[model samples]
Target chain A: MRLLIFLARRLGYSIFVLLGLSILVFLIARVMPGDPARMAMGPRAPEWVVERFRTEMHLDKPLYVQYYYWLRDALQGKFGLSIYTRRDVSQDIGEFFPATMELALFAGIIMGVFGIVLGVVSARYANSWIDNSVRVITYMGVVTPAYVFAILFLLLFGYVLNLLPTTGRLSPGVPAPPTRTGLVTLDSLLAGNFTAFFDALKHLIMPGIALALGGLSQEARITRASITENLQRDFIALERSQAIPERVIMSKYLLKLSLIPTVSILGLDFASLLGNAFLVEMIFNWPGMSRYGIHAMLTKDLNAIVAVIMIFGVIFITVNIIVDLVVSWLDPRIRLGAERAK
Target chain B: MAEALLEIRELHIGFEVYGGTLKVLNGVDLMVREGEKVGLVGETGCGKTTTAKSTLRILPMPPARISRGEILFRGADILKMGPKEIRRVQGQGISMIFQDPTAALNPVFTIGEQLMDAIRYSNSQEALGRREIRARAIQALKDVALPDPERILECYPIQLSGGMRQRVCIAMAIATEAELLIADEPTTSLDVTIQAQVLRLLGNLVQEKEASTILITHSLGIVREWTDRVYVMYAGGMVEAAKTREIFARPLHPYTQLLMRAVPKLTGEGIAEGIPGRIPDYLNPPPGCRFHPRCPYAMPICAQERPPFFPRGEDHQVACFLYKG
Candidate 1:
């Protein structure tokens, strides 16, 4: 019951945040020296046609009036027509959102698991050759962007080794399973198409890893530092004196306590994956929402731009709420204190 | 006196620092008898805590290395025990209560979780069921006089007051049924009003359980009131050891004498005088006696060689040239 209240409070705050984000994007898209209608119609189009397109788009109205109309339609799930695709902005997002979600979800898992495992290893063997090597690797991981890895993996795997599939969500001839959730891997699995699932998973590997590298490095570094710090804590001594095995102390006491800080940063890292996915998606031809959002931005597709921004805002806030809930679950002080605060 | 439960003979521990090793413990000797409360009293940095930690073999090794010594528990040398054997001795043979209750109990885990883990691991060979462990935990909490055993078990360490936390720590240390307990300044961080209560609780628990304890502290008053025998440490060495009453009545070592004088009297008579000069830098400690530079009764021979334990009376020994006879 207290959890429900906490979630409800978080959801309420999220709505306000998204609402502010919508307003900011709405005004910026207009004020940033571009007429969406003219850009959509392209150069050499007659002046009258541009004028008519502008009037039809409600672009000639006052900025507040335009925002109100856009918001009203948006609340009803109509974000007008995208200037780039000439499709409903909402429909475009719906079609593209699932692909990005799949990649982010896949990459997020990789980042979380491998990051922690590596971090534990690094911290356990601190000051040794293994720790030094991990330090060097993580340093390189942090400095290099996701797209660089994407290109490098493509060049090496796609061109030379040809070990993994480097393009799209699945092999072209395999045929997509029914678009139940639109995440090819999940949909294929749900449909019991093992072959399709395997193929989709294979396609996901390279892009997923490339996208995960940066966030994974950050996670490992944070986890290593936090665990190393926790090692010196007195509870560790108490655990040691109890004759608790080193394994139990490392996992139950040290890892659990150290994970709080690492988990705190995870929401931002995972959220940033969506923003960072634009280049990775484009390079891999993944048909993710970030690619669509990029096209929308290039053409100044006002409704599409605002819609994409709003969706990102929603995902970011939602991820934060989930992270907060996980943190509360890990720590009883936060769980009980949250109730007290209420 | 009962047979010795633990004995540390000529223990030398050093820390590898930037330039040189810090010789923290130099030929220190201590013995805790079966079912006897022994107070290891010394000021900070005097290696009392290091000695206690060494008994459990839990001191961080990279920085701290035992250069020389044998720590025997039940006639088995602890320093020679393998990892598996040492683990068996920990908690099952000897458990430790740390200085700060708040820091000793993990912040994230519940009182039940931490305590249950300790009990479960210590008795792993028994294959005890979950219900048995829970029952034992609740009983342990109850033994410590906590208000509600069930509720306290569910609460985190942060929820409890310092005294309560210390009580919980005592409960954890004693729950393993270890014969010997090493409490390193257990009440030092607690409130003054609560200190006596916790100490009394510890005393009662030790008596009730027929368990021996090595209480490490800087307070002579605690030692005088609580312990059977006292080993007064000075600059990483055992300056003197005798019956508690005898030590207060007649402090043999000059450092011990100064430590006794440093305690403020309740009558408001003379001011408490702390010993002059600081503990010598361990990196290059004084040659003959670590405490010689500060000894009021320092002699030429005191600086020439380290003094061995000289018997002054039955069950009393002091390391000072003045007692060379």
Candidate 2:
């Protein structure tokens, strides 16, 4: 399809972003205070053993040469040894990435759907009390931090009211569902463990709400503004003059035409959710890759930190490409512009 | 006139602004006879477009308020009609094509989709099949003399030229077979050559459809060439009204005479001069004659009190102190 070619071009740009991200991650891991080889050998290790470990780990080489070796090994899917976990960085990531994906996807869905609906309703009833009330609520949501909300929910609902769990992915008695997909909720359903499935879902609600709040409000504001501007366009006047049903005009013409900017914002919001979700994950004790990254940061684990950044870079780029494709599909002018350029 | 198709009587309109109400139209009267082309010429912000929009009852309220007036279509007041009643007349009894064609069309839709929508609105009485609407849309395109109507249908509005988009807008209005068609500066957005072509196309199509047309333009040349009657407006009130030839030959009001002098001749015998002063600020418009500030023959009464329309000739009227009863 013509759109496939557009996607291919976007994919090329995303790959370039990943490469830049890889280099940055490599440098950041090097600059942080801690010798990975010494840390690995331990403080009590003999001097010769520490020296051997440094040479083996390429600490003795220049930074560029070390980067080259790391890049080469990385390109082959070998992220090297994690000093903290004593496992391959890629293997640890393989386990945590799915959990992160599941949480982020759920939060994103909540943000996109509720955010856009609130925006449309607000714009539809602009200046009414309902609109004013919704504006106030969304503003409050936007100003509150995700971790603050997480802590609040934990205090109010989990600790005080005793209505929900405070932290942890599942209760002590509930077993982690058998790992087909590694996403607890989905795997629980696959294993027909209704009890575990519900327990996992209960744990997700607080953190999910926290993670979704900021994106939701931001998306709503953007959607409201874009749609309000679109409502005043000359084409809307044309549609009204044509005597097309108001329902059809609002849905088929107004909403679809106005959503391009909103969709673009949504894609970027999805990418940002990764960084924000890290806090939600930490506060709520959700086991996601970001939590693992946090652990690596505290311990100054080199391979693990680099690997996490690279994975995040990949996910962010992928989201951006999908968004570009969706936006192009919404507006035919983009494709026409491509043709003109050609 | 023989059973006027549309008549607007003593129409007053204003906008609610921050500090005060901005009066856009003050006691404006207009009449369009069956199958007659009437030109409404005015400077920008002279309430010409507001008057046209009021006829359809489509002006955005709060910002636009009809303080007092009656807009009558076929002797029935449109202001009194409910939404359903208005809908019946919107695309069938009356339709409007706007100034900027590109802005008037939704960019996301294909030409065919928008055209089909218009066709269905016009053919609402008959539950026409998709095939019938598609055929009529194509036929409407062909009527506008647009080439490759079939291929053009699939193309988005951005792909079409400015002139082609104007043609599509014209086609949509004419295809409805509405009794009264309103063209508000339909050629202003195009280049000079394209402007003439679009005007000619509009003239022919309106004549063929036998629809009464209300052409609002800044160009006096357009008014003289296309209209049977012309109304010259200044500052929210009608300055002069007469048959096109009569107005050009012997314009009664001083504003009308000055407007005639503003048009340049092709031979370039004399310089064409523009009228002095800007349009009055609507919030505090000149109390009496809205054009009194710029009138060469302004009398004491022209500023102290407003001039009522007085008959100058058969079916001709001018609002000025020199002719008022």
Candidate 3:
């Protein structure tokens, strides 16, 4: 019951934040120096045609009026049409957002799992050659941005070594899985197509690694530092004195105690990945929303830009809320504002 | 005579600090016989806690090093024991009641789960059924004077009060039925009234179970009331050690005398006066006796050579030039 109440409060705050983001993005996309209608129609298009497009979009109305209709339509799940694609912005997002979500989800798995494991390993072997190596690797991972790793990885492995496929969501010849979840790898597994599943997984690896490396290294460093500090804590000494096996101490006690900060960092990293994904998706031609978002921004596609921004905002808020819930679940100290369900 | 339950001999501990080694424990010797309550008392940072933690060998390495020591438990050299042997002896042979109850028990685990962890680690109780473990956990809590042991088992550490949490820790220490219990400043974090109650409870439990203990604290009153023997540490060196009554009755070392003077007596006296000099820096400690800089009767000879432990009375020893003759 307490968890539910806490979740509700977090969800309420997320809604308020999303509302603010929507207004901010709506204004910023308009304020930028470009005409959405002219970009949608070519520069040689007739003036009457551009004017007609603007009126139909309610761009002729007052800014506030335009926002009001935009918000109302959005709340009803109708994002206005993309100026360039002439397709419903919501529909385009529905198709494209899943790809980005898949990349982020897979990357999030890599980031969280490897980050924590490496951190714990480093801390356990603190000051040893192994620990020093981990520190060096994490430092390099952090200093060099994720896209640099992506490009290097592409050249070295994708082109030179010919180890993994670098481009597209699935192989051209392989029939795409029946479009259910929109994440091709998962959908392929769901359809019991092991070959397609492996193929989709192959395509995911490079981009996922590219997107996850920075966050992974960051998590490892933070986890190492936090766990190292926690290891000094009295409880650890007490546990050691109690003769608990070293494995149990690390797996259950030390890891659980040290992981709260790591998980919190992961929340922010996942949200930031939405922005980072633009480059990775473009490089790999993964057909995620980031690609669509970049195309929208270049053409001054107002509806598309606002929709994409709002979507990112929503995702960011949701990740934070989930992280909060997970932290509270893990660290009983943070479980506040909930009556103990007696 | 029967073998000592725990013996820490000529122990020298230091930290490999930024500039140089910080000598924390210097030529300290302590012994706790079976069923005896020994108090290792001193001001904070005097290595009273270090001596206690050393027996378990849980102090962090790199920063901490036991340069020289032989800790014998049940005639086996703890210092020479490998990791596997050390693991066998830690909870089964010796248990520790930590200082801070707030941070000692994990906040995530329930009171019951924490208690069960101790019971499970316990060699004797590991073979018991689940029902038997639960019953013993409840019994352990009851032994510590905790009410509603069953309900508390489900509640998280955040739900428990400081005293209650400490009682839970006490429960864990006692649950294992380990031969030696090292209560390091156990009551320092409790209310005065609660402190007395806890000390009394601890005293009773030690006596009833016939378990040896090393109570690490700065409380002279507790030592006087509960401990059979007392070792007074000063700047990581043992200044004086004697029967609790003997030390209080005639504290020969100036440091020990000053420590007794600082304590407020229940009867008439001026406000407690602190000792004149501060604790010496471990990295660059006073050359001779670590306490000589603060010694009221510091002769020129006191700065030249460290005072040997002089036998004073029945089982009484003082390391001060004043008592050398």
What global local distance difference test value does model 2 have? 0.87
Give per-model TM-scores: 0.96, 0.96, 0.94
Q: Which order, best to worst by TM-score?
A: 2, 1, 3
Give the candidates in order of DockQ, highest first.
1, 2, 3
Query: Residue B2 deviation, candidate 1, in Å?
Result: 2.1
- Poorest stretch of ten by lDDT in candidate 3 chain A: A333-342
lDDT of 2 by residue, B1-325 (tens): 5679898888999999999999989999899999999999999889898898888776777578998979889888999998777887886889899999999999999999999998787655677789998998899999999999999999999999999999999988877778999999999999898999999999889878999999999999899999999999888888889999999999998988988888898987888898887779899999899888877788888888878888988878998879866
Q: Write the per-residue lDDT of candidate 1 for residues A112-196, one digit (tens) a residue.
A: 9999888989999999999999999999998999999999999999889999998898897998899999899999999999999
User: What is candidate 3's lDDT per residue for B61-127, written digit by digit as tens?
Assistant: 7689989878999889998898778877886789899999987887667888778877777763347
Please give the distance, in angstroms, between residue B54's alpha carbon in candidate 1 and its true position after superposition.
Answer: 1.2
Winning model by TM-score: 2
DockQ of 2: 0.71
N/CA/C clash count, model 2: 0
For candidate 2, the TM-score is: 0.96
Error of 3 at B171 (Å): 1.2
Q: Which stretches of model 2 miss by more than 4 angstroms?
A: B269-271
